[model samples]
Target: MKLITKFVLLYLVVTIIVLGIGGFVSYHIIKGELDNELKWRFLDRVERVTYLLEQGKNFESPVQDNDDTNLKIVALPNRVEPNVEIRDTLVWHDRLQQMEHNLKLVAHRNVDGTSYRITTYGALVESDDITEAVIQILLWILGLQVIGAVGVGFIVSNRLFKPFRKTLERIKNFRLQDKNPITAEETSVAEFDDLNKFVEQMTSKAITDYKNLKEFAENASHELQTPLSIIKGKLELLTETDLSPEQYQLVEDSQRSVKKLSRLSESLALLTKIENHEFTGTEEVNLSELIKDSIQSFDEFITLNGLTVEADVEDDVFVHMHPVLADILWTNLFQNAIKHNVEEGNIDISLNSQRLRISNTGNPLSSTPEELFRRFKKDNVNSKSIGLGLAIIKRIADQYHYTISYTCEDGWHTVTINLQN
Candidate 1:
């Protein structure tokens, strides 16, 4: 439901509960007051009737009298001779019939010769009418209050949510490539104002970091490219000059260094692109086929190094990932295994639903496990290694939400990639 509707409904429910309780309380209070007033008016009428009988002012039968304003009256004859008992008996019977209103009648006999009973009948008071009128007015007031409460709730809730709505609009229009940050100046609440400020800071920081990283990558690539090109050009020119065996060996080493530098630059560019989420569409790829292709490409290296290769991967264990990234990960891993293995060493490759484990007999890394995955971090023993192979694998694993771990035990270096399901 919309926020405003929810707020209005909540307000209505609370208001109704409060008004119902108030109405019940008012009704009971009015009823008690009306009953008390009737009791008092009845007592007053009884006093007046008893006073009239004591004065002996009645000239007609009390039952048939119409001059009494208190209540109806009925008279009966005495059962015995002239005595207080007989007079009390006549007054009791007369008062019983004279109780015309909704009230009870009782008799009291004094020791004197004069005796009388009083009629107790309720009276109709104006307060009862006023109480009914007030109840009706309260009902009308409650209805007006409910309407007012709903109106106010709608206005307040809408105002409170307005900033969030604008923030959503701004987010929808935001683009990562846009250098300028998206900010909101309109806010209806303090919490939203703070949120807007936080979002602006985060977006601005992201833009600044992206620009700096891109510039650094470009500048570093250009700086490295200049020397590599000069070395290649000089090597081509040295081909025409007569040189000793040692000079020829030096030229070959320079060419190899230039080639390695070119490859390193390409790898760095690929890592940057992957970090930027450049790969978009994805498809299911069979791991067994990918490993087979990688093995075929490195078959010559495996044979020349006299390495034993073992594969135990399933045929249908597939993953939904970017094909190019998957190829790069496996290629780097297989190449690293071949490059770091001992002569005639055994390389074991295994895959299952849980993970892919590659183990090879090679020189174990002396650094800690945490530092092994860091870019450009290699053991000082192997200066020829570029140190970016495992780092690229780490980047790919992160993109696919996978886990990569390295272990060295008993002269065997192992790399495990745990696939996320």
Candidate 2:
């Protein structure tokens, strides 16, 4: 749930409990006060009736009394104890022809040697009636509170969360390589302000780190190229010097090692560039055409390896990729296939709208299928292979969010590439 929603619900729950308790207390308080009021009204009526009796107004006859409309006063010619009594009782209403609850008050008085008893009755509010009344009042109050709470939540929640929503948008669109990257937006709320401040610090640090890393990669590649080129030149000159057969063999081995080192450096630099997103230019590449061209280019190598080819490339199979990266991806794929293929074995290539699969007849791999995509991982550790070809292919595929899988069965190594988004 949203924070605003949770908070508002909690507040409403508390309000309901408070109102419920208040209603309960209010019912009892009001009922008590009303009972007292009824008693006082009954007592006042009794006093009026006593005064009329002293003035010789006969209360026995309704016409002669001229008072005590809701009272029954009677006298006995004997001395009796004087006291007052009040209670609730049920009485029959002659006109309404029904029984009704009432507050009945009785007074026994010894006035002028006569035991005078005066009774007064008042309409009583039943428990159910009083409860209903309190509930109505509480309902009205609760309804108003609910409406007000919802209104305030709607009004305040949007305003309060506006900065938070904008912060989310900023984070969503943030790009480390963008010239103008996202920075934290200023907010009035302390929590949101702190969040924005932290975001600003982290983004600033990330941009600084990215710049340093990218600069280091470029500088390192350039610096290494110059020294490697000079060393290669010196080795070529050293090869020209007349030397023993053993010395010449050593020179040849050193030259091969230097070339391998040069290639390794280039492959590593390419991997770094791909990771850094330097291949930003992208276009729809015709995979079918590219693979056909690649196969033609490596035809001599395939012939030298004594391998047979079977290509079922679908026409105009397109993928969104950088032209250079596309070429590198296919080149690495074809190279891996040919370099690992057995003599007089078959190479089967399939391409369609969904995926591309290349299966080459080769010896069973010594490493796991997953290890084929890891850098510096190879089937034969002693081979001249730099162990970066499949790694580079996997990295390029990953950069474009493509799925690449490897499988080996029956002396056939298969690599599948799915480029669909």
Candidate 3:
């Protein structure tokens, strides 16, 4: 729940509890006060009746005054009644034809050596009347309080949280590639200000770190290329000299080592560039055309390895990606297949809008398919792989936000890539 909503609800609960208690107490208090006032009036009637009897007035069936005070007086010939008695009882109303619950007050007095009993009745304050009135008033107050609290809480809280909402929007759009820090609007709230400062610091540091890493990627490839090329040239010249067969073999092995080292450096540099998001300009590239071209280029290698490739490529299926990365993606897939297949094994390639699946007949995996995506992980460590092909492909897929999975079952290795964005 929202903070404002919780606050409003809690306030309403407390207010209702307090109002209920106040109403309960007030209901009884008003009822008791009305009863007391009625009793006082009844006593006044007894006094008046006693005085009239002393003045030699004769007894009658009943007597009533202008205030509707019902009174009855009886002569107690040679006997005295109780000093005073009061109770609540039901009396019949002749005009309304209903039983009316009322207060009856009786008093005994002696006048001129004669005793008489005096009784009076007064209407009581009905508890139900008081209860209904109190409830109505409490409900009105509760309704007003609830309406006011919800309306004001939402309006005020919207303005108060505007800064937080803006900060979140800016953070979502922030990227290290932009090289710009997120600057939030100034606010009086301390917590929001703290958040703005922290995000700015974090993005600023990330951009600077990406820049340093990018510079290293460029330097690592260029600086190492010069020495490697010179050494390769020297080895090529040494091959022309009159060396023994064993010595020639040694030189050939050294040349191959140098070439492998060069390829490894280039592969690592490419991986770093992809990680840094260097290839970013994306266009609709026909992946179908790229796949067909890759298969044709590796025709010789496929034939030499005694492998058969089946291509079921659809025409003009486009993927949004950098053209250079597109080429690298399919090339790596074809290379991985040819490098790991058994003799006279079959390679199956399928492509359409929704997916691209490549299944090849190969040996079982040494590690789980997931572990193969990690850098420097390989099935055959000494198999001239350099152990970076699948890792590089995984990075390129991640760069384009593609889903790629590897699985091996019954001597068939499959790599399924979901082409949807």
Measured by lDDT, the strongest candidate is 3
User: Model 3 clash pairs?
Assistant: none
TM-score for each of the candidates: 0.57, 0.69, 0.71
- Residue 358, model 3: lDDT of 93
User: TM-score of the candidate numbered 1?
Assistant: 0.57
Residue by residue across 62-160, what tens digits does model 1's lDDT show? 443233323543343433232111111112225345422233344343323544444433334333455567678777977897788777866675676
lDDT of candidate 1 at residue 78, scale 0 to 100: 39
lDDT computed for candidate 3: 0.87
Model 2 pairs in collision: none
Compared with the true structure, all predictions reach lDDT values of: 0.74, 0.85, 0.87
- After the best TM-score superposition of candidate 1, give how far the Cα of residue 72 lies from its true spot, in angstroms: 50
Ranking by TM-score: 3, 2, 1
lDDT tens string, model 2, 1-421?
9777887898899999999999989998987888898888777777877787778776663223234336766786777798899887787777667776677778997666788878777565765679899999999998998888888888777898889888988888887777455567778899999999898888888888889988887788788889888988988998899988999899889888989988888899899889878898889999999999999988998899899999999899999999999999989988888888878989999999999999999888887999879999988988889999999999999999999999999989999999685
Candidate 1 error regions (>4 Å): 1-185, 190-194, 201-205, 219-227
Tens digit of per-residue lDDT, candidate 3, span 1-421: 9777898989999999999999989887887788789988888777877788778877685777778778877777676855888888888878668786777888989888888888888676555567889999999999999999888887868887778878988888877778898865579899999988888888888888888988887898889999999999999999999999999999999999999899899999999888877788999999999998888989999999999999999999999999999898888888889988999999999999998999999988888999989988988787777878888889988887889999999999999889986
